[model samples]
Target: MESNYHTLKRNYNQLIVITHLTQLLTYITGFGGLVVPLIIWATQKDRVEEMDAHGKSILNFQLSILIYSIISIPLILVFGLGIITLILIAILAFVMPIVNAIKASNGELPSYPLSLNFVS
Candidate 1:
């Protein structure tokens, strides 16, 4: 019973981490939100299966947005086509992560589309 309780708590903990990790931009504590999940999941790999699942989801979401920004930065100057759209995309990139965190917190495994999911 103790083991089962511990497992349940750990799973919930992972969900909590995944849910709040994206709030980093909103304030500041969420800064490591991008990396901490991976670290925790890696270190406690066998302790909670949910940790690995949520961690990879969060990691990939951040990484994909990162790649999108990298590609967009260069194209912005070269094309000069849609500055407003670009800005919105940038904002969405940041906002979506937070949204994902919120969804995860509610025990929903929200998967961002086109994410790399490198950890998996």
Candidate 2:
């Protein structure tokens, strides 16, 4: 019974970590930032409420960042401001999810600044 509980806890933690880190797939698949979490959240949301919350938060952040990146493209022709904006987007995309994953692992609710509630 004790071992079973430990296994369950470990699996729960794994799911939480995966939910946050799967956004890294965006680098490979281009749209994985939203697609991966959407898939995972759809599959696991019923099994784990925490995953649902994490999924919504991640989706909101990803959507917000996507919009910001798109808006920055025009600035590239302006004063090279788009270059800096792109760099910041890349940094935020790479770092914010990891920070949120760490917080999720420790059973804390993670909040992404600049995230808009697209998923509720």
Candidate 3:
């Protein structure tokens, strides 16, 4: 029983890492950033409490980024500010996920600044 519990715990930890890192998929699928984490969270949330919490955090972060990007679209008319906003968003999308994944791997809850609670 103890071994089973250990295995379960290890699996949960792996899921947490995945829940954060999977956002990188957005670079390829163009939309997988949110979809992949959503799928994993939806499926594993009930099975593991950690997956549920981390999944929500990841989803909320992605949703917040999406909202910010959408709002920046109109800035294109204002001295090309939208271009800069988009570039920053791109960089954030790339860097933040890896940072969060590191935190997850270390058994810490990762929080994203500017992330709105869209899932919770």
Instruction: Show model 2 residue runs off by greater than 4 Å.
Output: none
TM-score against native, each model: 0.67, 0.91, 0.92
Query: How high a TM-score does candidate 2 get?
Result: 0.91
For 1-120, candidate 1 gives per-residue lDDT tens digits of 999997888677655555445435433653465666556657765766565677677678767766666777767788865466468655765676677776766667666766776767
Question: Between 1 and 2, whose lDDT is larger?
Answer: 2
Runs off by more than 4 Å, candidate 1: 1-11, 18-33, 81-86
**Which pairs clash in model 2?**
none
> Per-residue lDDT of 15-115 in model 3, one digit per residue for the tens?
88888888999999899989989999999989985788888889889999999999889998876899899999999989999998999888888878889
* Ranking of models by TM-score: 3, 2, 1
lDDT for residue 88 in candidate 1, whole number 0-100: 62
Error of 3 at 48 (Å): 1.3
> Roughly what TM-score does model 1 have, to 2 decimal places?
0.67
lDDT of 2 at 20: 93
